[model samples]
Target: MRIAQVCNVGEICGGTAACAWSITLAFPDVDHTVIFLSPPNSRTVEAFQHCQFHSAKSITDGMIRHLNVDLVILHNSTPNRVAQIRSTPSIQYHHSMGSRTAADVHLACSKWLHQRTPQSTQVLWQPTPIPIQRTDNPSRNAATSLRIGRICTPDDRKWPQSLIPLYERLAESFKNVEWEFIGAPGTLRESLQHACRGNARFITADVSARSRYWSWHALLYHHPTISESFGRTVAESMRCGTVPIVDRKGGFCEQIESGKNGFLCTNPDDFVAAIHQIQDRNHLSQLSQRAQDSSHEKCSLSIFRSRFLRILNQLSLGDSFDA
Candidate 1:
């Protein structure tokens, strides 16, 4: 089946771009094409050599005539694209928590996101892919606390500032723990650097290599976010065997089981206390193991492919279109 995945493929920092990449990679058997609205840079354009890339001006005509894409997957926050592709058999994947007017099959990454959308909209829950090699680490240290920093575009909805206080408290309250910030170097990194002033425990580094970005040593610390359709980083952290301390928001409340796979905090105080309590090696080790297990069960490539293909089959069977 020919599938056209449409989104802003130029964006490398946000979850939307990451989700698009993952989806494309997961379903390699189906002929895939990525339609980018903006002019893609050399790096972005080169990344998806396996899939056909088309510019916005020629996307519609190509989709209708040349490609004849059987299924079109539209990433959220692209209403104009959705309107343009409304006539095609499409599935809208909601990567953000907001209202959308157009889409054939509306898939929400979290329950919170689904609740906010129109009830009539066809919704499905699918977590973002967490690509990591499943390895049995015999030397996995339980006592060592690794606090991985987050990388986010400057958006109030993501609550980027929430990490400052949480990290500060972690540094002050614990000694063995180390914090590292990874992502594109920007105002957020500068802000985090300034916040870590006089506090040498917190370290910041811009991500240079994509391969090392999601390493097992990087334990993700995501504080409360105002709007998140699904926390992709949470799954990525778990896939790498890095424990995540997420604020109870959006789908995080549903994804994380406190004291099992990861820690969930209600507020800044609760967040700080949770970090302090899990400072021991034993707890971190257990959390890491549980995280790896949980990721394998829910976010593994095989499971993702099965669920996605099932959805596609259902859509195809129900629709009048012939294969």
Candidate 2:
């Protein structure tokens, strides 16, 4: 089927952009096109090489009509363009649905969003692929210090001032532990530099993704947002065999099995406690394996593609009706 995905392909490698990346690469068989709402960049152009790329402003309904497109998927749409179209099957594939309730079809990224969406809105669970393959055995060097990785938006929610005390304590108590944070605000960057001024304990990186999760023991993902719509990075880390110590609330609870696959922290204290729980290499290694196992079993690429194809088949069978 001919399909078009409209999204804001920003420079920052966010969950939405990552989801789009996964979709394009996984479904190359379909006549898929990405209509980027934002200014196109080399990064996005290269990423969507398999699919046709177009700017949203340049793309008219006539073009979609000309292509005989069957479906239009909206990603993070604030003011949906789907409302203008009456002939095509438009689905709001939501990362955040905002205030709108009435839509032809609403596909949620997580169960949390599905539960929160209007009952009248047709909600379906569409899990995001980790964009990486799972490793059977996670790597760990017993001779070196523990490596803890964190990738966040640099907001107060992700890198809160509240956690400053805990950071100080962790830096002081565990000299063997090294914290690696990526994408932080200038204030946070300066503060972290000051905090770790005496030693080389905290390191900041500017890379696409740390592929060394296989070597890392755990990923600390504690955000003040209470619950995320979906924890994409946490799942990504898990796919690389790195256990995530995530928050207990929201969509994070859906991703982690709590102690089995990964640890779920309640607060900063709980986060500290969770770290204490990881004492030896054996426990860390086992949790790492379980993390990858859970990711492979729960959020594999095959499952995503299969479920997506099944949805399309149902739609083709005239099962897609406005809720």
Candidate 3:
């Protein structure tokens, strides 16, 4: 069947974009057209094959008409787009539904995200995939000291000012620990620079590419976030055999099993203390192994594709689609 995946493609360089790509790639037999809200970069556009791309403004006229789209999948709800496409068989896969009106079918990346939507909305759990292959890197097991890291896009909503004091304290208290901040360089430069100042143990790394970002030693540190639908980076870290020290917020609780896979911190002091506790080589290895195993079962590409296809079948759209 002909399907139209309508999304703000340009705005998505992270998990949401990866989810869209996974869906399209997984169902290759189905005719898929990506209706990008904004034009994607040359590299991003080249990634998808056998998929037609259209501008958001022309989506209503050009996309629906030309493609004769059987089903429209809305990633993020646009003001009138959902209503406009309501007549057609549409599914709204919410990265974060926010305050928008519910769609015909709502899919959430995590249980926390699913609960926020209307009860009438259909809930499908769609987690992000870990692109990096699992490796037996010697460095992952060799380190005895805790290596805490944070990844964000330099948004205040993500890396809040509250984390500044926490990060400073961790740097000061921990002797054998190192803190790394990875994201857009200049965006959080001032804040990160100020927080790490005089604390030679803190390192701020500019992550312009996914490869570079995932190359670090494991044991990610994510403080409590105010608003997050799902944390894909944490899962990705797990896939690379890196344990995550996440706050008890959003999908973090769902991803980690407290001491089983990784530590769940309630506050800044708890986060630091957890780090100190897991600094032992044996404990770190066990945690890393558990994390990798968890990623394989819950967030792997194969599992995501199989679960997604099964969901479509249960929705009775599987037979309708060519694949």
Best by lDDT: 2
On TM-score, the stronger of 1 and 3 is 3
lDDT of 2 by residue, 100-137 (tens): 32335667888887777663243343444553333542
Task: Look at candidate 1 and tell me the lDDT of residue 229.
Answer: 62
- lDDT by residue (1-323, candidate 3, tens digit) is 77788776543444555567667766767787787767765645765555877666534534455667777777775655534454456677877866443455667777888888663244454554555433442243444555556776434556566666776677667755645665524545566555655432333322233332244555555554465677777777787777788777888788889888887788777777777767666786788789889978887766766666666775577776533
Give candidate 3 regions above 4 Å deviation. 28-31, 46-51, 58-62, 86-88, 99-103, 119-122, 133-139, 142-146, 154-156, 184-187, 197-208, 212-225, 320-323
- lDDT per prediction? 0.61, 0.65, 0.63
Q: RMSD, model 3, all Cα superposed?
A: 3.8
Candidate 2 deviates by what RMSD? 4.4
Summing lDDT over every window of 10 consecutive residues in candidate 1, give the lowest-scoring window: 201-210
TM-score of 1: 0.80
Answer with 1 or 2, whichever has the higher lDDT. 2
- Encode model 1's per-residue lDDT on 224-291: one tens digit a residue: 53545676777766776777777667777776788788887776677676666566667766878898
Q: Is candidate 2 or candidate 3 better by TM-score?
A: 2
Instruction: For candidate 1, list the clashing residue pairs, or say none.
Output: 142-281, 143-281
- Going through the candidates in the order shown, the clash numbers are 2, 0, 1
